[model samples]
Target: MNVSKLKKGVLLAAGLGTRLVPYSKEMPKEMLPIFEGLKGRVFLKPIIQKIYEQLYDAGVREFCFIVGRGKRAIEDHFTPDWAFVEYLERNGKEEYSSLLREFYSKVESSYIAWVNQPVPRGTAHAVYMAKTFVGDDFFFAAAADNVFIGENVPQKLAELHEKRSTPILAVKRVNDPRKYGIIIGREIEDRIYEVEGIVEKPKTPISNLANTSLYVFPPEIFKAIEETKPSVRGEIEITDSIQILLSREIKFLAYESQADWVDTGTWETFFRAIALSLKHSGGHNIVFDVLEALREK
Candidate 1:
């Protein structure tokens, strides 16, 4: 089974990100700076870009970005800037020019289309907006706020999806499963869990494996979403749709990520994610040196 043959993807980035408050007031939380350079050119790639790059690496060529009304910034970032490229070339910054050109080329090739979700809807609603684009096939879905950091989790999941011929949900075992959508399953192997049931934010969780907001879904999921009812909060929950699919005897599998999963919705988590990213960037030693220099100054 060649998973690379399936070539479509979806990214959910329509949330208001109210938890980040003042910082999110001006910019999308997904666009928050995770790291900065001494030259003032911040390495502030959004969560969307990280997910996009991962999917791109996993052989997903067409991307459907489900965006809200105020997410023009995201669209703009991926848009080609011919004028900027020309300016860089005129100034003899050939390296910078080439880099931007390469980035835009990837965007042009992979960005199939964009779907607008006009209202501040829930995850299910955002996903439903991509139904037209998804058509009738299995596609990859990832939340913009959650980043999967393994060397090849995306590639591994893609391969697993093709081999198993089923929907795959990335799950991780946490001490407090009540804070997430928990999955009850038979442990097939060290990190592989054969899911029997899924409960969203259960009061008394049956299992410690919680949904990590990354999934490869079959087209039938759209139908499940349609049949799903809104929760007490008047929001269409994706978890409800998953439950419906499970009731229909759909085969759902859970795979644990080898790398860390970070949720940057809150300030604490956001800072932690930033620190983790910095450490991964191989600049932690430099950071310590800078701190020492500051102390001496």
Candidate 2:
């Protein structure tokens, strides 16, 4: 039983977010609030926090967030503020702040780190920045834009990687290949696929399996990235790097995300992510609440 032991995670959060515009001009989109609520008092958990929490719960404690300029808010949000906690206690607002205190403690307990990229590069380049942190160990890589639901999908990827001893990718079956990275692979069994190649937004449709940008990779990928050439988009593509692995006869596999893979990169997708989260939590106000929330904003 060779279970993959992926202990570290690399989150690519350095995108310039031109699509997000005016709001993203100052703050990194990762730091934007998914929803503000009272954790006793008002608590604002940013989109990246939800992303990190999901991976943290999946048994990844040591993390490197690949960030760029204007991302200090993300770093500050992760920093433990003991003095603020003490202020609440001194003012006898301890009960009101307990949940936040615990939340901060959970985050502080983990070894979360930040690495800055000089510029906004493609996802692969952002991940390449983590080479010094990841070394040669197998690590999980996920883009911050993906807001996944339910129990540990990283665990699912890890388990499959363990059995197959191959790199694992999380994917979902979608109708449009033009909209996502299409995976061309042969099914070994059921939903499990032995990926032969992957193309980024293909003109001609390949399999409708969309790569969710959630992956468990062998350290060798850093070398592949180094060898990769910049694409027509003028950024190094992870798919190009993965092609190197396939070219070398390395076995790469894809795992179907049992839960939905929600894209939270743009305003529209972010809104949908919030709605889905509320709906999945069985809150009856999902429809009106999400709509009104969007309207009011």
The 0-to-1 C-alpha lDDT of every candidate, in the order given, reads 0.80, 0.81
TM-score of 2: 0.88
**Which pairs in model 1 have colliding backbones?**
none
Off by over 4 Å in 1: 1-3, 35-44, 89-98
Report the C-alpha lDDT of model 2 over 1-61, residue by residue, as the tens digit: 3234667899988888888989898888877665433432333456678778777766777
Model 2 weakest lDDT span, ten residues long: 35-44
Give the per-residue lDDT of model 1 (tens digit) for 95-211. 678767867888888756888887865788888898988899898888888886545567878988777788888987788988888888887877877778888889887888889
Whole-model lDDT for model 2 versus the true structure?
A: 0.81
